[model samples]
Target chain A: MNVVGRRTLTVIALVALAIVGALTAEWWLSQSPDRPFGHTQAGHVLGWAGLLLMLLVLAYPFRKRHTPGQRWSKSLFQVHIVGGLVGHLLILLHAGAHLHALIPVLAMLAMGLVVVSGIVGQVLHALAFRTMNEQRRLLLHQGLPEPEVEARLQALAKQEETFRLWQVIHGPLTVTFVALAMLHIGGALYYGGF
Target chain B: MTWPPPFSMYPVLLTATLVLIIGLGWASARDPESFWAPGDLSVHHAGRMSCTQCHEPFRGATTANCIACHADATFISQPDSPPQIFHRQAARERARCLTCHTEHRGTTARITTDPLNPHSEFIFRVTGTQSCRDCHAGVQKPGPKYGLLNNDAVRRLVAKGKGAHGPGRFADCFRCHAGGRTGAERGS
Candidate 1:
C-alpha cells in the first residue's frame, strides 16, 4: 500500500482504540456506583492486564536484537507499539474519570506522556521514508551519479535523526510510569486492597 | 546536521530517571504511615486525620474499633443513629461492620456497602406474600421531622393506643395490618 494509505490506517486504528476506551469507561461509570476504580474486580482485571501488556512491550528491545528464528523483528515491533497503546488504554480504565488522589494522578500523567511521545516517534519514522524517497528522486533527476545520490540521501537521513530525540522523552517517561505503577500497586496492597 | 541524541543522551535520561525514582522512594519512606488513601471519608469522619482512627496499625481495621465510637450513647441518641440495633445483630453473627459500612467512599456515600433489605431488620422473617412497604409505609418520609406514620415512632403510637384501647387490644395486628385495620378505640 501507499505511504499515505498506510499512515491513514494507523491513524484510524489509533482513533478506534481511543473510542473503545472512551465507551468502556463511560459504560463502567454508568453501570457501577462511584466507588474507587482500583477496588472493583473489573479494575483489578484491567490493572493486571495492563501490567502484563506493559511487561510484554519491554520485550521488544530484546526481540529486535535477535534473529529469533521464525519470528520477525518487524512483527514484534508492531506488537510492541500496539501492546503499549492497549495497555495504556487499560490503565486509563483502571484509573476511571475521578482522578482524586495525587499519586495515582501523577502516575497516569507519566503514562500518558510516554504513550504520546512513543506515538509521535512512530509517526516520524513512518513519514520520514516518503520524504527521503522524494529527495532521492530529485537528486537523481539533477544528474547526480548513483554514489553521490546515495551520499546525499545519507545526509538527509542524518538530518531526520532529530526525531530520535523522542527517545529521550519516551524512555524517561516509561521509567517514571513503571516506578509510579509499582508505587500504586504497593500502596494498594499495603492498604489491604488487591 | 545534528543527529538527535548523538549517543550521549541515553546516560542523561537514565540518570534523571534514577534520581526521580530515588527521590520518590525517599519521600514515601519519610512518613512510614504514608500510602495512597482510597478517597475522602464521610463528613462526620472528616476530623479523622489518620487511618489508625478506623484501621489498625497493620492488621487492618477490626469491628472493635468501629464499635468504639459508633456504639457511643451520644452518637446513638442522634436522629439518624446508625441502626446500631442491626449492627448488634451483625456482631452476634460475627459479621464485620466493614461488610456494610465501607469507609473512604466519599462525603455523601451511603454507608450501606451491601444491599441491606430493611426487612432484614425485623425480628420475624418477612415471608409469604409480604413486601417491605406493607409494614413500613412512610419509612422514608422526606420532610424535616420524623413522620408519625412509620418506624419506631409508630411503635410508640401503637403502645399509647394499646393503653387507650383498654389493655390487651390489637396493637400486635397494628404492626402487620396497619392503622386502618384498627377500629374506633384507636388513640386519637
Candidate 2:
C-alpha cells in the first residue's frame, strides 16, 4: 500500500525466489543423482554465464562513484539488482547441490550472504530515500521557508546515514565472495581441465 | 529523527565474515587437502593422498596415470565384459579416464560410471548402437564377440528359454561374470 510496505514486499519476493531456486536445485539433484547436471558441459556454461553477470553487476558501483550524475544511473542500478539475483540463481543451478570441496562451499556461502545483504541494503536505501522525499513534500505543504525545510531534512539525513550502514556488511561479503570465487575458478581450471 | 534503527545484526554479521575469511585463508594455506579436496578418495586409491599420483599439475588426471597400474591385456581382450568393452572403446578414442571414472567421492563410493544404467550414451557413441542386442546379436550362440556364451553353464542358461534371457534383463551381467573368475566359474 505504502512505500515501506512495497519495499518489504520486494524483499520478501526476492527471498522467496531464492528459496524456490534452491528447492528446485535440490529436487533435480535428488531425481538424477547418477547423472548430475553439474557435471555436464551445459552446467559449466551456466557457471560462466552467472559469473559474467556478477562481474557486470560491479559496473553499477563504479558508475555511481565515477559519474553520479550520469543519465543512465537509475537504469544501471536496476540492472545491478536484477542481474545479481538472476546470476545467483544461475549459479545455484550450476552448483546443483553437488559441491563437495571446501573452497566452493565457502564461496557459495559468501555469495549467499552478499545477496542477502544486498537485498537488505536495497530496501533500506529505498525506505530512507522515500521517507526523506515524503518529509520534504509535507514541509513544503506546511509553507516552511526553503532554508528551514533544508535544515529539518538535515536531521533526517543522520537517519539516512544509519540506513547506509548496510554497506559495511554488504561490501565485505562481496569482497569475500569474489576472493573465494576466484580461488574456486582457479581450482576448477587446474583440476577440472576447463 | 531516524524512522527506524540500524539493523541489530550488522556487527554480528561483519564479525562472522571476518572470521570466515581469516579461518578459510589459514586452512587453505596450512592444509590444502582439507580445504580443496572435493571429497574423500575412493577406497582403492585411499592410501595415495598425493594428487599428483593420478593428476598432472594443471592438466588434471591423465589416462597415462590410470594405465600405469591397469595395463592388463584382459581389459581389451574381454569383449563379453561390458565394462571392459566400454573401457577399450573409450581408450581407443583417447577419452580422458576422468570422464567416466571420477574419484574423491568417499571411500566406498562407486568411482567408475555405470555404463549400462547411467551412461548408455557411451555404448551408442562407441558402437553406434543403443540396445544390448545391437551389439550382442549372437548372445544366444557361442561366438567371438560374445565369448562368455561359450561357457557350458551360460549355454545351459541360454537353453532355459526366452524368459530368462529377455532383453534388458541381463543388465547385471557382472553378477555372473565377476572379475578374475574364469568363464566356467563365472557362469557357475
Instruction: State the C-alpha lDDT per candidate.
Output: 0.63, 0.69
Q: Residue by residue across B30-121, what tens digits does model 1's lDDT show?
A: 64333366666765576564666666644556778777876645444544422544554565677877776666666644445453332232
Clashes of each: 0, 0
Per-model TM-score, in order, reads 0.63, 0.69
lDDT of 1 by residue, A49-101 (tens): 99999989988856644544445477778889989888888877777665665
Residue B48, candidate 1: C-alpha displacement in angstroms: 1.8
Q: Best lDDT goes to which candidate? A: 2
lDDT of 2 by residue, A55-92 (tens): 99999978866785566477889889999988988888
- Which segments of candidate 2 are over 4 A away from where they belong? A1-3, A6-10, A26-35, A68-72, A144-159, B1-31, B72-95, B114-188
Model 1 clash pairs are: none
Query: Residue A73: error of model 2 in Å?
Result: 1.7
Q: Which structure among the candidates has the greatest DockQ? A: 2
